[model samples]
Target: MSAKITLIAMQVCGVLFISNSAFGQATPQDASVNQGTSASQDAELEVLTVEGRALSLYQGNGAVFATRTNSDIDKIPQTVQIITQELIEDQAAYEISDLFRSMSGVSYLNYGIVKMRGFEQESQVFYDGIKGDPFRTFTIPQLFNIEQVQTLKGPSGAAYGAGEAGGAINYVTKKPTFEQENTAELRLGNKGFFSGSIESSGPVNEDSSQRYRVGVYSSTEDSYRNNVEEDNLILDLGYAWDFSNDSTLTVQYTHFDQLGERLRGVPIDENGNFLTDISWNSNEPDDEQDFQSDIFQVNLEHSFNDWLSSNSTVRYYDTEEVIKFHQARALVDNDDDGVYDEITRRYQDQTRIYQGIDLASYLVADLGEHTVVAGADYHFASEDEVFYYANGVNNGVSNLSLTNPSYDSDISAYNATLNRDRLTELDQIGVYIQDQWQATAKLNVLAGARLDYFSEDYIDNEDNADNTSYNDLGYSVRLGATYDLNAQIKPYTSFSTGLTPQTASDQEDSLDGELFDPEEAQQFEVGVRSYLLDNILNLNAAIYHIDRKNTISADEDGNTSAIGKVRSQGFEVDALMDITPRWVASINYTYTDVEADDISEDNTVYRILANNPYHQVGVWTRYEFPAISSSIAFGAEYVGERTDRTTSYDAPFTIQPYTIYDLSWQTAVQDWKLQLNIKNLFDKEFALAGFNEVSGAIVGERRRIYLQASYDF
Candidate 1:
């Protein structure tokens, strides 16, 4: 069934392209209408006044956000998806993951972890086009101060720094506006959930040359999982000064405090059946994961002339995280019983502190028919970490029973011993340049290249004999072309390469002092984009293949090697339509196939990548009634079956397919707005494939309902 659906989707995509190409010889009136539609869409967000305020440094142009180029998106040959503030508000998204349902080829794992295309991404997230956030790995990303999100699919090493082949996500934060605006909101939900927030932005002086923005948010919730709850607080403050008509300087400070317990998921039997309640938590009652962060940033934008400009940012970050948890190591049967009776659990405690500084600057020049962008960035980061652990077998602790569990045991009884203490420092410098040129009346070409130098100094405080340092230089390149077939259709093709550096820790258990090489990735893509139905419907379709080499793996002796290879290919479609005066709808679908070579067997066999589905679909529709100033919306997501492939498991396990639905309503009266949302409306019971055999399967979210109220002044 999955293969059949994939075949049909390919046919549908081909047909759409063919039909649009055949319409290239349009009539004069049709061409004129299309020209108007294109013009209107191009100027949609160009001008901002009292009613619509600019949020970020690049929001005013609308031409450069994700790619950092002055060229329009239609002319760029990469797949870029943008989630607007209006859509974010309509969905009432609290965190970045909440908006993943509307994006193509994207999936949420846990916390800030995400899977794009077919590869898992943990450290690929960015902010304002810059890489690295101190707390990204420790805490969930809140949306209170974020203006929009841009998903750049495919290898972007040439434009950004080192990254995987899957893609990257950039969060555009809000900036100070010269217009006065203030809002206060409160929300209440089931499961002991509550939240409150306040935001204000306006001018600091009578001349409006100086602007200020401030926001405060707090929330607490007891999640669906047993013994899992979270409390969060966030604060943002920003000030901007227009020192000159063509130059601006902005300063911003942000702080975050988060407290939560880890959700390790429930164990499953060999038959792919849950061994206990889905909500069962393996962590102890006192286990907690806490994160605290502080960030300070400065941005400066200056126009050298009508044809040249520069944008630069310097940021400093400090963060700390502490965690203690119980992890299920493996399933065991005491006395050789046919049925699994005992589970090996490990208790662990860790503390880490990270500090970093990042600097990036870009110069954009418009030279006749070509727009050029050149930039350089520098990053310096240091981390101090300590770890302690105690395993059931190694410590002679009693194993927990699989079918029967007791939570009354004092966690202190399992005394964890010192494991490792480490301190590391990393420095990276990158330089890149790109040019977008109009080769012909209907042909646009883009080419870019980047070079990076990175060095890592690792020190094992516990044993200086284990210390190691490594440094290397790497390069990436990108080339793409787009041809406008007609007013409504454009076809494009691109080839790009990416690289990810290996840390010293990845080779801790290696033999012969053999260090691993950086992973290399390359992708080839072809796609078509169209504006149909007099610009009421927008559609984009693409097919791409990505190959990654030098993936790290371990051998039977626990020796690490970079001999693994993985490949992923997929077809995607995204469409947005205005069905009528009061109706709006959007749909996206993705079909992915991924295979990885078995490293343990010396790459003799290929296995399907676990935790990723072959087919996924998303749909959303909304209707508005002007009479009551209200709107209602419906959303649905479908995930196809997946396989759990791991050497520890005797055989491959299959995870069934599932679908989830959501509904929401919003209304406005005077200056007050009210909203309600029901997620997982049908309360479906489902589970997702986990990282490995030991991690087990994760339980899906249950039904949740919430109400919100906001007042504007």
Candidate 2:
């Protein structure tokens, strides 16, 4: 260890010994265990290590349910993927935005939006099963307070009421624990990185029945460009009362505000292929601008009993953005190709608002050897988005021709591009109920359904498309069965459905309205899960095939269309093992095949979104020195190459895989402990993301470093 690292470790040890007098502490297991290629036997089992990676958490059991996941991939009755908090720490994810780049079965676009299963993320997120859309102008998922992030695949309209045709992401917030808990973190690295946060959770009463938790995070950093920068602030508060009885109530609040430069995407040449390698339009003078958002939300949960509970929520948000992009493709074109004739510049300004409430409850009952569970919920939501654009018209001296300014320059051209606007608004309501029944000691059956009503309208002055309104009544049904394969294992099978409402349906050849269908998906899946080796090990695996119709996507005509045909098939496995005292590890893998109707179609090719990868794999592990415990963690993880993408009508952009290594150590001295981290140890560069509209892609980051000191109060 370096001199700096040695000193930090000494300080960390000092604080740990000092703090022990104050108090003590803290998983989903099924999700962590199921990823192994073969969970075939009791002898090969062990607890896994996937913590703080996604929505997964480290439960009191020390089992890494790391994804807040279940034992069987089929447990959720839908496609799912989780990145654990452990994985995030291993990869040195400073901003939650950086986490998406290395995850499999998912990809990022622009800045923070994620695309899953061949479709862009449109409607799949839920927090403990509640609505949480980061795409909205007002809401942003703050990572410092996040426990895990859960992604539910396919249309969620059935359960979430109204949803995107694509999918969604839910960021589970960290909650308070019975034991008094406190932690502090500091990170500094590439591109002028710096971040710090402090959190504490403990009892509010002597009996330790009531508890409170609070956290705050702040960071100021610059972008890849010399002139661009970012600054962020986040605050979170939470409380819960156990009353040491049957009833419990919990409430939590969070806030986020950020300001940063607008980074426009690189442009493409006449052929629509990448024209310049990795170039910024202009870090020029008078070309600077900023974007910002303020977000706030509150949630309440009350439990009537072990078998029943209900939840409610309230939220508000605001945002603004200003950005500039130089048509590098146009500026480089020496030929008078028509590609540079019709479009020059693109600019937009937007405003949005959202508000909602939810009420739901569940019941669990037992009869004979049967366990039956039933639940229902209702939600009301409203949202709006408005955008204004200015076409590039003021560059003057325009022949608008990419050809060098020649004798024809005297001919005046339109001084500026067109000025236009666009806006979208929606109102929605939903209700649903589900039940699980055990018919025999060896067999279990699950069934459920949901109903939703949604109304939406959009107006685009740019295209003179106004008040285009759409509405729908949608429903979904699901069925599945579980059977104990033996003393330590169970295998299961499930079938479920989902939907979404989109005006593009009116333009479909079938024009299947609500009566005909809202959109459809029927998934067939089978998997197995086991807890063996004295509860120290767990394993799970599953495979699935999905048949979907009424899928919303744009067609070759540049007109929106619900293809009524799209398919995704994949397999996944997760595993974790407490192989031995102090040594822990976890792994997860997914492979998907996407087939869409627009694959071979002309103009619709790009609109169909065919460029995303098909295969994904992730693995991570850590070990603590048993002798010192504080000897600390050593870890690494990898995201495999992508072979299939649904972009440009199936034109593929296969990305090679890359792995990341991370290390950390902490020890306490007399009054405090110090810590240090090194991320992306090898500085591997891999594809982070890209859009079909352009032939270019986003690249991941290089090496980063940080060191910190903490002293307990």
Candidate 3:
């Protein structure tokens, strides 16, 4: 059934392309109806022109992913997706998960994890080209001050060292512009959600050489699950200065504070079915989670001449978190009723702190037909965590009944026990050089290589154990070429390699206690991109195969080894078009297949990779009625079935597929604009991800509605 629907959608897109192409070539005509009019009192027709700006949703002018420099997307020779501010506002996206619904081959998982190209992408988020924490707990970053989001799919090790196989996501924040602009907004929604925000930017000096900008956001909301609520506040400020010698410097700072209730996974029955009657939150009403972060960055660019330019950047980041909750331990048949009767509970307290610094410098040189870039970077990061756990029959926390659950239990009898106190430190340095050669008018070549040195140290204070340290040096490379068939079409292919160093703890329980090697991945990709109907429609398709080695796998005896391998191959297609002056549409489809190789005879790796769908689709369209100053949009998304194991060595279980729909409307009157958004129009219920039987599964969100009003001056 899915195959048939995909075929029909492809045919319809083809028809629309042809019809729109023909319509674009038609000529306009004007008729002279009133030829006889008195000279003294001539009837006049008012000629009012209603000019419209060209749409930016389908346009990809410049990007900085493939290389550190801003270049045209078609010349990058990779799969890059850009989510513009216009699209974010049109979709009314508030968080990173909300933005993922419009993208292809990307899905949200538990605890800040996202699956991209059949691989888990964790801790690969960057802010203004600097890497941030990968394990952000409880809440994702809000979109109140972000300008754009860029995703580069597949291995990008040649440019950015020590990354995952799934690629990287960069968040570009709003910068200071020398223009007078201010906006104020208020939003209200279901589930007792409300928010207010303001943004202001302008010049600070008479010559406009100095500029400043500020943004503030505050919100309070309740979740669909019982005993779940959130309160958050965010602030962003920026300053920029342009010197008389053509040099520029910019500084930025951001602070975030949040307090919310944590929601654990839902329980499952003996047959691997979700317990529909149970609430998503498994803890008491008094449970709490807190997060705070502060980030500072500075960037400077100087030009000595037309042929020589240099750029430098430095960043400092700090974060702290505290969590207190009740965790589910096990499911047992205490009553002997043939079904799960009770759930054991455990009390936990955890505190974590993280600090990091990053510095990089780049030099760009031009020589005839070749343009080269040389850069180097250094990173230092440290983490400290303290954890306490309490588990006993007489503890304050009470066991929960599978059928009748209550959250009013007190924990006065619980005694906190110190279990873990650990400190981890890491340092890395990398250097690389890239060359872009315009060999001919229609052909281009790109090549680059990077060498990186990494070291890590771990200390366990509670046990007074010996300090463990690991160090390694890794190298990555990339080579690609692109050929233009015509002014409207380009075909390109690339090969790249990636590397990630292993930590000391990864060898703690190994059979031989030997330090493991770093994980490595290699990829080969080919794709074609086209611009039709005078650059109004953009179409792209690509196919790629990737092989990852040195994956950590464990045996039945609880001993670990890095002797596993997996291969992923997939194909993707994306289309963005302006059907008419008042209509726009986008469609994307992805097909992924992942398989494990029998590298070690003693290891079982069949069901280690889960929660990745084989087929995914997303489609959206919007129309504008200029006469009424209003616009409307509608979209739908589909996810295919997935398979997972009940335990490490157990047989696989299949999870069913599901689809969701969304709608939005917006209108403007003078300086005020009103918008409404409806998500999960059908209120569908499904599982987002799952692990072992005892670990249960994460449930998807239900229906939600939001209304917003804004004024600009």
Candidate No. with top TM-score = 3
Per-model tally of clashing residue pairs: 0, 74, 1
In model 3, pairs of residues that clash are 123-134
CA lDDT of every candidate: 0.77, 0.53, 0.76
Over 4 Å off, model 3: 1-55, 134-138, 269-272, 392-394, 510-513, 533-536, 556-559, 599-608, 644-648
Per-residue CA lDDT of model 2 for 1-713, tens digit only, reads 13333443444454456456565432112333333243334566564533321223322222112112123343343445566675555545555565654344565544565556556564455655565443343223457777666665555544455554445576766777677777665556567766666677888888877889887766766555324566666777888887547655677776665655445443343223434433333222223334444444555555466545445555444444444322212232335663432224433344444444555454444443443444455554444444444335454322222222222222133244444354555566665555556566566676667776777666665665444667677787667777876746878777767766655324333334232346676667777766667546666676777666765454445444555476777766666667565556566666767666633354343433433455555555555554553535555555554432224444544444566666666565643557677667676644455443342444455566667655444
lDDT of 1: 0.77
Q: TM-score for each prediction?
A: 0.88, 0.76, 0.89
**lDDT per residue (tens digit) for residues 417-444 in model 1:** 8998999999989999999888987899
Residue pairs whose backbone atoms clash in candidate 1: none
> CA RMSD for every model?
11.2, 7.8, 11.5
Best by lDDT: 1
Candidate 3 structure quality by residue, lDDT tens digits, 1-713: 23333433443344345334321121222221112221121335444322122236533456775677766677878788888887788778887777776676686656566778878787567777777652375557778888888888888888888888877888888998767666667788898777777676768787779988888777777777767778777788999999756698999998988788666766765444776453555677888888888988899988889887888889888988888888777777886987776688888888889889999888988776888999999988888999987774565668876566778766666777898899989899999999988888778888999999999988888765656888899999989888887757999899988888887666564568677888898889999988778756778889999888988876556667776788989998888877887788888899988887744332245343577789988887888898998989998888888754355445555555779999999998976789999989888777666654555666677788899987665
